[model samples]
Target: MTAPESGDVWSFDYLWRWQHERGETEGRKPRPTALVACVKGANGRTNLFILPITKTRPSDDRLAVEIPQIERVRAGLAADLRLWVMIDEYNHDFLETSFYLDPKGRIGRFSSAFHKAVLAAFVQAGREKRLRKVPRYD
Candidate 1:
């Protein structure tokens, strides 16, 4: 499979670490994530900025913007799926690191207008202090 570019949605084997009653445990969770940006590091490896795509609506609508069903379908998502771009939920990973990009998980690239809106939301989130981590693409 080729490297994912910005606006492309792919399936990822995400290591979800959470606190358990006994201790911390990790689970391999399959999730659809969007490649927000790709940056070349000093070491020459690409660093990927990614955000999770979800069917669940965020309590704060400002944190997430809904993708129209038709657009979502065009992006290779299920036609009946109600998807939202979770701008506030994002993380960075090196292209050669622990992140696993599943070939079968490739959805499709979002529209240019949607990409622009997502970038705008990121900026708004930063200004509103709603984002836990500010995207480095700025």
Candidate 2:
């Protein structure tokens, strides 16, 4: 729990941008989230960025990557359940001190190759300047 690696998947309260825009401070429930990055800010606190995974198929307007069947198993999710990781947006939280992230909530991890693919797509999303970020901490 001290150091969050990029491929790690965990049950997290991932707040969406729309929810925050509506003045919602916390996520509705803890769901599977993909750890994208962990950065140390100037103040020395580690910032955790994550993408939410959902079973609902993304709309045409949204950008998402489907979790491969093998990778799904690697992540400890139901092998038969179709899931996608939304790359167009991400949830930001404090890794050093967070009320939403619990150590016991950790699931399995995606393979390095899969994580790399997701990261690549995420970086592409960033380049497009359409990535919506929802900051969970004040």
Candidate 3:
């Protein structure tokens, strides 16, 4: 199982290519960011991040394509991520627009309350593990 290059944003096609070459079964889901937990990708559930090739890199210093969203949200390391079932309501509008961590530290993306719940659950689980301690974002 090959992991994406650190600090690099990956396009859908590129990610699919990697999956194909590696015989992975994790398909692209309708999420704002292209990270998912697959029952058959590397592990049962893995932290994978993907961004389109067009807006891959936004930082002037970094020439590589990396999503600034990840940095803002303070997601835990791969070993610290929690796997939660993605409900249809939570998935709505997730892929249509980009998400950001607001000044209040709450997830600011889609307008779906369900999605917010899912993200909150993930954060809570990670906190319990103490693997990734994001500052209070209540």
- Model 2 gets an lDDT of 0.90
Candidate 1 lDDT for residue 21: 25
Q: For model 3, how does the per-residue alpha-carbon lDDT over 39-119 read when each residue is reduced to its tens digit?
A: 133433333333222222234422222323443244321223332232111111122122321123212232233334444
Q: Which candidate is the best by TM-score?
A: 2
Cα RMSD, model 2: 1.1
lDDT of 2 at 47: 86
Candidate 1: pairs in clash: none
Q: Could you tell me which residue pairs clash in candidate 3? A: 9-65, 32-94
Evaluate all candidate structures by whole-model CA lDDT and list the values in order: 0.68, 0.90, 0.29
Regions of candidate 2 where Cα sits further than 4 Å from its true position:
none
Model 1, runs deviating above 4 Å: 14-28, 133-138
What's the distance in Å from true for residue 42, model 2? 3.0
lDDT by residue for model 1 (105-129), tens: 7779888778778878876877887
